[model samples]
Target: MKDGRHLVWILDDEWNSHELEKSMYNQHGFEVKVTRSDKLEDDMPLYAPCADGVVAQVGFQCRADVIDKLQSCKVISVSGAGYNHVDIEAATQKGIMVSNVPDYCAEEVSNHTLALILTVTRRLASYNRKVREGKWDPLDTMPIHRLSENTVGLLGFGRIARMVAAKLKPFGVRILVHDDFVTEETFNVHGVEPVSLNDLLQQSNILSLHVPLTTETNNLINYERLKMMPRGAFVINTCRGGVINEADLETAIKEGHISGAGLDVLEIEPPSPDHPLLKMDEVFITPHSSYLSEESIDELRTRTTQAVIDGVHGKHLPYALNQVKTETKI
Candidate 1:
């Protein structure tokens, strides 16, 4: 392990995130390069030094086509909670250990979820819009609801979902979770009742989606699923945009099947100005900032560094995308 030439690359969009990453790697005696850009076509020039090990804040696709351009990329890490941005299967095939710093922002994101729920439920955005538009009497026409004694259905029972459950406990809300990965031991530990998807939709007063976006999970909450939900039920999506099916959600909201939505993500990041969801008074959005906060950033940086170290050392990594361990475990 002595005198190994270490290089870490950050392909992300945070303006000053590079400095923090550089400082961490510099202290550890590793050469670091941070290429920050929001526009892919314009920013390609900045990431010219992308070397052996790559750590990304939000994974940008690193296909074998571009991996062909990269001389040495031993490992790839997603800096945020989600890994869907990375072509995981592609990276795994290239023998690169793809990992994620998943748990660092669990509470922060769950908090954002609740914020969205409260904001939309209370018509915070609608009220703000009316106030800004100089309509003092719009409150009379606003549709608002109370959060007390409601049933909250979760799409997944991951760390973030569990955090949401814990936070909602004091609201006298019943927690109904659905995750094939969650076991009975977890149920006994948390006192959260496991329910099927259909049951969650049929009984929940507030349906919050927390599942990651994947091939099988894409459009998971389509038109049919939305119809199953109780009329006037609120939907909060702190999870992925693709899972809910943008078209289906827009229709559901338009049809008044769902009362409101608190969305932190969209079908496209930084959705176009003309996006219909942006104009909906019943919808509240936050530019995918659910996983962002000062406290979370500090933890994200530290966890990202450790994931890189673990990936390089050929040890187990948290949320590894590569099937190396699955293919060969001791």
Candidate 2:
């Protein structure tokens, strides 16, 4: 602690200002240090040994080497839903709680997923480009199917995926979901049919992925899976990009098996200019901003700060992703 106040390190440098973080932590009788580093892992040595709590941004690596160096850190709170960046196993063994704010951006990401779904389903981009080029015919983008006739399938029935289902209910589309963790009653309550992964792929006219990236899910949507979908099927991914093999996806789209795609995240952020997907007019890529909105940003900051505050105060960390045998607390 610094000056008898708990010291929290904000290991995030992407944000424009730390005023919100400072004000929140300060009001709770905590001292906040803002660390800026292009390589947080390389600079972890300077902050880990003294930080009472650490707030790490999404995509920041908190590997075992860095996590083992944390001397006083009670908790490492990830500011986003995905905690794959952190070494949860190492933190657990070190008695440091690992938490994430999964629900903070549920509305924003679900809305973004819906937006991508509509963008590809309606062929909006194709028409806009045609209209801009002085073409007036709607037939410029042919083979557009009615949304009501499309069967939308969700790979995971998490908070965001459920919200996506709620939003799509009015559209008269049949929604199928596949999640091993979800119970049958939950699927019934949501009016969605739970199917095997194979059935989901074979039947969905529009497949939207929401599962986190893991060894089991990496490249889950490859060329073989793409072939299972009906011809001209559109793929949407607002979650982890590694879930789909970029190379296989390009090949499927090139072979005209998969129609088009709306991708908010890619296997690599700011993919190199020569990335094959960059040249595909059938693909729409966003800079992984699915969880962005002023409201969501404020909520994210508030919840992330709360986790640190709880940890520093010796309270159980909220939204904890892992269990620890002991937590270093005041």
Candidate 3:
């Protein structure tokens, strides 16, 4: 280490580190380097060799090849919760700790999920558009069911999903949760009914995904599973875009099988302007911003940087996703 200062690299063009956060790192004797690169593979060879730690953002793939080339990197800290883009197995083999900031935006994401559910159930967007076009009619939003009579299903009962359940309780909706890892006590505590995956899909009037994107969860919601839901069922996703098969969802909406969808993410971010889902009146899309709030962003940045600092100092990371035997000395 030059002058006993650890070298940390920030690899994301889209997000700039807060000045205060940088200053804190500097105060801790860290030499922070910020690099903006659209292509991670092309840039890693040049920068990874010098970096003692790295804080990666979404859209930057940290695959096995990149992890293999990290010469001095003792830790890789992900800015957000999901770390599917990073090859944890390879990093573990190389004795590099991988950490993620998982709880920073739980409230923001849960709030966004509730917002999507309300928008779809109330048909607010469609009505607003029609009214602006001089076609206002109360009957335009017919078949609106009372929330109390409908069932809202959660695909994963993690922290965000629990928050969503708590918020939806006031709406008087029946909540059904499907998660393999959660126990019966968790369901009882939340006052949510636990069900199998297939049962949740078949029974929910609106299904919301809260699972991470992984090998098992990628495209977890495919055509067959989409068809399992009752006709006219609505779908909502605030989790990883790859969890659902976009092509199949489009087909279900087009064939009038599924009523609508409220998505905060897509299989591809900033999808082509002419994408089929963009043209559908029943579809509501956000720019993968379900986890965004001023407070949440600040928390995410602070926690991520702190994790990197902890790793460099040989302290155990609180949000470590994988255990690694690091060779870096304290």
Candidate 4:
């Protein structure tokens, strides 16, 4: 929309290279400029504000102050499913569309979710530690339950959660879900039982959180909620870390009420070395890698660029998260 070409600013630090984005934008007659700064407020130059579109990564927060500086920005394409990093309200008010690639890593994340479930349920990590410590006895970690006997509860029924349900079907485990937004027909189609939040907390033998982090969901699984689960219940979270109160989780685990947990994310990224959960043998942690895969990354980049392209051309944004009016068009 500027200088006879669409201008895109890549404000991201997660990826190693912007060659993919640059190539994609260049093919569409667009000029792409990248700022590999994780913190835009401290690092972005003032002249960088005149972008027609933006491609953002999780590490960069496009807050109200930052969004206000984008004088010509028509759209912002977040490179991943979660758009929590972007100030959606500010963008909408500024007539800038916000889009996210929600389905790009569905398979990868679902696979990681199932893997974490199995790792905790089967006591794989505990046994592995024992074996390494020269303890060679299966009874060292007994009471391993069959996956079919344990009820697996999914916190949300979005694309990733539904894919998880489909993957869990062949395992024959009873799946319970608690998402007020999801209809009963969705539960029936997936052969999952729809339950109230209280029931979900009380009945699930293994609970996996898949909800987004918002005001309502932040610290949703606090001390009281964790206590509601059956004693010795396992917890799995592939979603946002803020959804669970980390301090309360540690207390519940220390009290032996919650048996174990598989966490792909934490309230803090790269948690401190002395973090209580990190030292617990009952807890397993992955470095926020649930959504990683070569194919997934490729798809994410392609879709994210396409979103900006569509937005600058005044076409409907396929993965739009907010409504906005823009004057820029092809």
Tens digit per residue, CA lDDT, model 1, 1-330: 113657676676655646666776777677776665446445444342345677766736655554444445667878877887677766766667788877888878989988887887777877777888988875565555567757889889988988888888888788899999989899768878898889989988788998989889998988899989988888898888988888888899899898878898877887899998888878888888888888988888878887776666566775876674333211
TM-scores, one per candidate: 0.87, 0.96, 0.95, 0.96
lDDT of each: 0.77, 0.89, 0.87, 0.89
Tens-place lDDT per residue, model 3, 47-133, is 777778988787777778877877878889998998887889998988889999989999999999999999988888899999999
Name the regions of candidate 3 deviating beyond 4 angstroms. Answer: 2-4, 39-46
Per-residue CA lDDT of model 2 for 80-188, tens digit only, reads: 8998888899988888988999998899999999999888878888888888998899876778898999999999999999999999999999999999999999999
TM-score of 2: 0.96
Residue 306 of model 1 has an lDDT of 73
RMSD in angstroms between candidate 4 and the native structure over all alpha carbons: 1.7
Output the TM-score of candidate 3.
0.95
Cα RMSD (Å) per model? 3.8, 1.5, 1.7, 1.7
Count backbone clashes in candidate 4: 0
Q: In candidate 3, how many Å is residue 7 off?
A: 0.4
Error of 4 at 166 (Å): 1.5
Give, for candidate 4, the lowest lDDT window spanning 10 residues: 38-47
| Top-TM-score structure, candidate number | 2
Candidate 4, superposed: residue stretches over 4 Å from native: 1-4, 38-43, 326-330
